[model samples]
Target: MAEWTIGGVLDAIAGVIPDRLMTVCGQRRSTFADTADRSRRLANFLAGRGLGAHRERHTLANWECGQDRVALIMRNDLYPDAVIGCLKARTVPVNVNFHYTPREVNELLEYVKPSAVIYHRSLGAKFADVLPPDALWISVDDGGVLPELPSAVRLADALVEGAVDQRISPSPDDVVMMCTGGTTGRPKGVLWRQCDTYTVSMNGADHAYAAEIAEKVRHAGPPWFAVSPLMHAAGMWTAFAGVLGGQTVVLYDNRETFDPKAVWATVEREKVGLMTMVGDAYAGPLIDELQRNSYDLSSLFAVATGGAATNPRHQQALLEMLPGITLVNGYGSSETGNVGFGRSQRGDTRDTFELRDGALVLAADYSRFLHPGEQEIGWVARAGRIPLGYFDDPDATRSTFPEVDGKRVVISGDRGALAEDGTLRLFGRDSLVVNTGGEKVFVEEVEEVVRAHPGIADALVVGRPSERWGEEVVALIARAEVRAAVTHDVLHTHCAAHLAGFKVPKEFIVVEQVRRLGNGKADYRWAKSAVLREVTPA
Candidate 1:
């Protein structure tokens, strides 16, 4: 396989296939030629503002000082060009979650110390006061009531210049940082070399397979839609895969919030073939929308989910709605890209994912890889084509990316077991594992059972402080129907049928909604806080 940089591969593909449609968002569409030409001009635009890799900087109080960073805080619609332009200019593109509060935005910018920012006009207010005074700002129009940012350059004005390709040569080792927040408090940037990320997560094809993938896209590729926010690693990677394969990429144009009906309408209009979403956060609403109205969904052949766990009930519901459609659950993270894929059948919708090459189960001590049929639950890990480490976080990098048996591997925080059939049974993150009365219970397992209840819309389980037991399992449930219908006794009975007695929720906190992160991940921190504040007796 010939090593390929992100910009190099994109340019090579664009040069060969210039007339192909590259992206579609609402009323706007860009072909490969337009994307290439516009991105090149944008890169030149950024470079003209003195944003490039070679720009030296004074060492900050504690942060590393090198390579100019360009923060991206926009939605999925205009994300590709901003990212591609940054890469073409050899500038690091840092992901900024737009859902973050102003304080978080300020904190993240202080930590990242980016010299430039590309943000949506709708989100300009969030960073107007917090953005670095010297940062070069460019705002993309979102056709909304936008805040005034006097110092920022309008995207249209920037793109008015003549098309000129950036001649900057980017090394395969150029850094592409993905900012992610987990159960841990502060967000950390996971750093990956462009080459490693390309091969690992970006649907990289080797010399032997590149032509085949390109040809397939050229001949029979369907329009691809990433329903997840582009700020998320999975969302960006999924959309980028479309560009790599020379397929038209589609994004939801609605900026206010996720509207399932709007997504369905876009699919019908665009004839989207492949749609990617982040688990039940998206699937649950989509299911409700399907039940409410009839949609012409024959064009959608596959729906792939990742970045969060997809409950079996939702999978079953989707399968019932769209018979003969493929439902795929991609299990991996920013650190370990596309490690495995779980396919759901009509009746079998278990969370058992088939392991991809380089993925394995690690023993409890993290000393050796567990062989197939290992009874003990262990950490899911991936070797080969993994990220270098968390950016500027040596301690975290050392802990997450450890060398075992003379081979470096990424220890994804997920806990699971390896079946005798060589499939992995994921049991949520290790951090969320609960121990009550000396019995260990996986939160995801119990949550899955709770969500299966007909009246329950969504659920999150966390450990609460208890006098009798060290920590008791507590469930925070979202009631979709009558709250009385989803009684504690009823949910307990339902859970008891699928889970062990100890795994059942000892306490239930009913709510109208369950909160999720920008990437559709369960906000464990929020759950824990809510349980302690509301459920715990003073």
Candidate 2:
């Protein structure tokens, strides 16, 4: 069988379905032939500049990389091109959060130590002070009026100057670095071999050879729309899944903010069959728009959400609006790729996933794997085709991906227990657990009950330092409207019936908006700070 590297898969698919549409972003659309050609040109350009793999994976430590790193700091439009090109050249493409502050950007860049940086020209001024002196800079046009970097090469010029006919070879061991959002702490790069990534994230497990996969894609599938930023793992995985399946990948166009109307219009115009989003942060707005306006959404067959806790109420509302559509709730993270998934049934409020192959719940003591009907809450983990380790952080890599019974597994930090029937009963992240008055409480349990309230639009639960108790749970809520009939007593009564007394929040602070990361994961750091500011006396 051919090696399952992303570059090899791309070559096979392009060879078979070169005329099919590969990507669509607003007025921009590219065919497999065009995208493959452009990617080859970019690969040649970077290779000519002496950037490629310097050593194989076996020659380096788990926390070390010998490939030239290229930081991608642009939006979703040309992201596939950049990644494919880097892979073809045997270089690692690092994802950069474009919404990060200058300091955060500097910290990430310092850690990754990329040999090249590609960013949108509109962001040139943001990196002027902190950009490394030795790295090559390339800028893409975002149709914005901003000063260009003096040392950066325009992406257009580089593509034209690049040679198109050079032979390229990419190894399966080439690394792909995915950086965590760093909401709780500093961002860590999770490195995965390209072949393993393809197996775990790109449906490589279903086929034995790249030629067979390409032949299966003789007819184009319906377009898959990515409603989240590609810098994050959820969005990137979903988009690449479409590409590997020979489906048209549609990117959300509005970069500054998510415009629900614009998203639906694009879906309608493109006849998108599948749309992926990040839980309720994106679902709530889209639901509100659907209630206010009418659009032809007959083409949309499935709506998949992951990367955060999805509210079941929102899922029900979406199902009611679009009958006969499947609502898929996926479970996975950067460390564990595509662990499991569950579909939302009509009138069901619980989100439970069936563990995929190689996924199991580890015992609380980390000594062995748990069996079906295990009563103790354990850590959710995946054993095969997982990431290598956190880049340059051996301590974290060892802790997160420990060996149990001589077998390596990636612990996803999510606390869950196996049911008698062998399905996973997922709880909130164990890292975010709160201990108040000697009782451990999962914040997600409280937040789930709070969001079930009719008046609550969104909410986040966090722990704050307390005098009587070691730490107290506090809730930050965003109401559906300013005048919504949501009061402390009403929420307290609602939560009291569904949760243990200790799990209930001590106070609920109403906020205009609940802050979230660009990819819609809960910003626990922001929530903790907000709670501190609200409770502390000036």
Candidate 3:
């Protein structure tokens, strides 16, 4: 493998190919030529705003150097060129979540202390303080309300000037901070180096998935539909892969809400072949949308759902809804690149598992088995692609990323076990254990039963803090609006059909919307907060 940098990859792609389509945003599209040209201009624009010059040369001791960071907060618009600009100007792009409130956004900015922050006007206001007080805040309106940042520069104006290719990388190992929240309370910034995140999107465009895409969009570059958030590697991988692997990227501006009807309609209308999904959220909604109206889906060849533990039932329902489509549970994280994953054949999993060096497994005590060399099952460990551990948090790095048996590995904390056939069978996350009267309740089993309810759109299992029982099992459900079909009594009766007596939630709290962070993950902490706030004692 060659030493890869973001700029290096771009240069290689530019050398091998030109005039290839890179991105498709609604009616607009950017060719490889366009991306390169615009990135250079954006870099120049960024540099002119002192993002490169930085108004000073900081010294480590006596030797002075420029160490500027440029942050980005926007939804998936399929414009890798903007990200590419950070590499050019030796700037690190710290990801800012658009869903974050002003307070949450400021915490990220305080941690990064970026020199310049770039954002699309669509989701940039509350995140204004994510940059340092004295830092430059740049704005780009992709047809939205443009916030007035004091030193703001328009991206369109920069692109109007001629673009020239030039060097713009600090180091291969320099951090490009991308933030994602987890079961933990606050969000942890996953920082990727210029060389760390390999683009597997270009291994060979003749593969089955790529070939299927090529068959649909035979015009120019390989086209991919962006479904996940731009901050997530799930979305970034396809976008970059499409660019390097000869595909055009089509971004679905979902605007933080997953509307299955609109997504399927776009896929059929624009002829999207490859897209990403995150577990049940994508599959279930697609299945739900099917009952509403039938849409043409012959164009879609594959959809990779990841990020969370998916039940076999939800996986089965997805396939039942849309037969003949390739539904794969492709697994990976911010720290791990494309590791070995299994494709569903019979009921979410009937296919045999091939245990590679790094396979995910469920441990005996509801812990993640990361690595097991000799025909053993454990949590999946892909230390090879571990992100620069939770930016600025040494304690977290120690806990999550630890050295076992001499080599450093990332402890995913997901539970799974190994089969004799050398495949990892993931169960659920370690933190998802529900304790009730000293008995441990795994949420995966409970969620499986509760999600089976016909009227339930979504369900989450969380333990409510109890003074008497230690922690009581509670379920927060997002039920479909079917004229009061699912009352607490009805759902409790439904759970009795599948779950053990004690595993059933002690109380049911119904809500119009289920709170979730990006990548279709349930924010259990917030859900618990909401449940605690609303629930009354008997």
Candidate 4:
């Protein structure tokens, strides 16, 4: 049987294709052999300091982690190294949002109780006062913006040049923690076994042996450019999946912000084959860049957007500009890996996905699995190769990942319906659903119609308080230009044409920009607050 461990598979790939390019970020490039060596050294360093699996998965509860945790508070450059090294050493790597406020950072760190922290020098001050005193601090240089912590050790200095440690064994049951962005509420740590995460993240590309995977990767694919931040699951998983499949992974260099021009130039120069982005927050600017200037994107074949709501208008515009390119909209969450994906080409506008194996729609009440042709909306769910549960939250763990018909499945808050043909009609997150006058309206559905208008640049829909109706639908619109002729009546007319009368926005507030996280996911909390501030009497 295969080990099915990340370190084991990575080692096998390195043995087979030692000279293959593994990662490229700006001028820094690393081959598989070089990466493996560095990873082994880091693993050894951690192991020597007594960091490894302390207990097996079966020995601990679903929400409990027996392994030491390391918080990763850095950008894309050395992010993969930290994850690979921690896994190799049997230490769980927890993702920390670099864009988080001081209080948010402190709260997350306190919840995870990480034993060590790997951060960029630019962000040292944020963690200095909040980090656990006993935690090991390993800092990476980021233009030397902030002073280093008192007990910090440079990453380069910690690595020791030596042969791979033969005695260090990694288990398939070892945990890999992915922390949610806390956009809806407080962030919870979703924990998955190494084997399960590898299978799911690779879209169920599992083989019996590491040697089999190595042989299959003999002919490497074209380079994959990961434009999303590594702190997010979408970005980290895509980059890891690319390397595991024997493809060079290109990291986006703009650490502070997303620069579409620089991204396109890098894609042209590196000949990036597939680029991963997070919806309109990325696609809107990229479309603007493409319209303003042309680049040699001959090497680009596929552009995939995930981890957020992708505007159909942006998708169609991209398809029109890049002839013969496939626009893929991936559908999944941190709890359930890659459940389904929708593909679009030139002249195509629909956003329905064929559910993968072990994925289906549960009844609205979650009493049973809904079969194809179910007219009622339900929760989108996945059974096999799912996470163990959210760490340290037994109640949430049981509620999110429950047993149905004697089978364990994870329903990650997505509301959708199954078509007669078995395609999934996703209706955004259930948390974003607005109930107006006893009618449930999916915000994504309304936002789609509003953004389709030529004058609108982007829009977010939320429910605000109302005297008559339980809650009234409200839209926050950002125009394409300051002087663009976008009004509440114009948007209402456009939305009314495509949607039911109740789904139309009752009120519209023009804003400079729609609130979004660094990873392009909607900031619902921000939107709701903005709406409250606007509607509340002064």
| The candidate that achieves the highest lDDT relative to the unseen native structure | 2
Q: Provide the global lDDT of candidate 3 against the true structure.
A: 0.62
Each candidate: what lDDT?
0.78, 0.83, 0.62, 0.82
lDDT of 2 by residue, 192-286 (tens): 99888887887664357666876768887679999877888888888998998889999887457778999899889999999998766678788
Candidate 4 stretches greater than 4 Å from native: 1-3, 161-166, 181-184, 432-538
Q: In model 2, how large is the Cα lDDT of residue 243? A: 91
lDDT of 1 at 429: 67
lDDT of 1 by residue, 1-538 (tens): 6777777677777777888888888788988888887778888887777777773322321123257889998987778888888877778899987766566678789888898998989889866888888888888998878665997888888776425444577667677888865343356788777787877788775544456445645653779998887788888888888787778889777476778999999899889899998776678788899999998989988999887656667788899998867899887877798888888767667568898879998888987889888898999999887877776777888888889888888998888889889999887666776655334456876787788888888999998765444467999988877534877788888877655566688888886678999999999899998998785321
Q: Give the alpha carbon lDDT tens digit for every residue of 1-538 in model 4.
A: 5547787777888999999999997678998888888889889888877888888888999999999999999989878888889999999999987765565578789899988999998888855888788888988887765777898988887785224463578888999999873333366899999888888886435578776977877997679999988788888888898988888999987456778999999889989899998776688789999999999999999999876656667788899899778988887878998888898888775568977788988898878999889789999999988899999999989999999988899997888998888999988676776645334466876787788999988888898766444467899888898888877777778777666566689888888889899999889898999899894311
Write the residue-wise lDDT of candidate 3 on 338-438 in tens digits: 55467764345554334444434434332444343444445656545455576666777776666655556666665455656666666545577654433
Cα deviation at 37, candidate 4, in Å, is 1.0
Q: Indicate the worst ten consecutive residues by lDDT in candidate 4.
A: 159-168
Off by over 4 Å in 3: 48-67, 129-131, 145-147, 160-170, 182-184, 199-222, 346-348, 351-377, 432-538
The residue pairs in collision within model 1 are: none
Off by over 4 Å in 2: 164-167, 181-184, 206-208, 348-350, 433-538
Estimate the TM-score of every prediction: 0.79, 0.82, 0.70, 0.81
